[model samples]
Target: MKKLLFAALAVFAFSFSNAQDEGGSATSQGTWLIEANTGNAMVGSTAFTFTSQDGESVYNLGLDGGYFISDDLAVRVGLGFGGDSAADTNIFSYRLGAKYYLGGEFPIGVDLTGASIKDAQENPLWLGLQGGYAWFITDHIAIEPGLRYNLSLNEDFTDEGVFQFNIGFTLFL
Candidate 1:
């Protein structure tokens, strides 16, 4: 998990200086955006615990899609897989939501996501909000680093509050 965190940070650092200093407007309406997202929880312990104690890192790989309803607004959906070594758990997660692009030469924005997590014993739901700066490295590619806060709707199989740092790439298609 620590390695995962470091790797993500390294990627962000490597790309940071290369990103154009100029700002850009959001995707235009009718444009399609596809993204590959990777992230894990910001845990207090290292990865080898093999138990849920001291918290565990839960990693996720996902595919996300967005369609601009207008230049400043878009609807999005995602599908993902998640796992944790400490809890010995594997789950399928999905989300549906929207993001309103804050227009600028360099775009920064917030997103509201509603998601579901399902496993063998229980299924839980959460709502998450993320804030980040979108760095357009190219005409069709962007790197987004964001902080997310999730509030669980039920405690049956999850924590009440979850937080994570995420980095993802969006490709305008």
Candidate 2:
């Protein structure tokens, strides 16, 4: 997973550098993005070993709106729903970040996110940080890959730490 994330970052880096050399604009400013992600969530501790969930895929359908603060910088916010087999979680994720446009038409950004996931039984909130890169293959389509590290704040699950690797396509409208 780390290797794949690095490779994706390399590709995005190359594309972004090339695009910048050719002079790209903030045309994608105010653009709306819809994305989906699938990955696993691990829960365990040294004292108590919890059974790991298999094929624990999470589907995130989100809408992001971007506002360009500068040619190479933007602020974005997204809201989405995340769910797995055992629970359906509703998440409100807020990111305050900036984007740096790479040469071709691609962009990379890092975000500090606070997310709250609620289910019928418990509500767990997490504070996480993520870095992502988007490779724009076309004006309307892009491939996005990201890495997230989250620490749970719930007392019962305080020891649980999650690392997620995600790759998905984003459609701009």
Q: Pick the candidate with the highest lDDT.
A: 1
Residue range 1-173, candidate 1, lDDT tens digits:
64785476456545543343333343777667666655554222111122244676656555777887888677888776656767677656667778766762233333433333344555666666777777877665678777777776657756777776767667654
lDDT of 2 by residue, 41-108 (tens): 33211010112357555444444556655555566665555445455444444444555556525456
Q: Clash totals for all models, in order? A: 4, 7
For all candidates in order, the CA lDDT equals 0.59, 0.50
Clashing pairs in 2: 16-102, 16-103, 17-103, 18-103, 19-103, 19-104, 20-103
Q: Flag regions of model 2 displaced more than 4 Å.
A: 1-36, 39-60, 83-97, 102-107, 112-122, 151-157
Ten residues in sequence with the least summed lDDT for candidate 2:
43-52
In model 1, how many backbone clashes occur? 4
TM-score of every model?
0.65, 0.51
Model 2: per-residue Cα lDDT at residue 95: 46
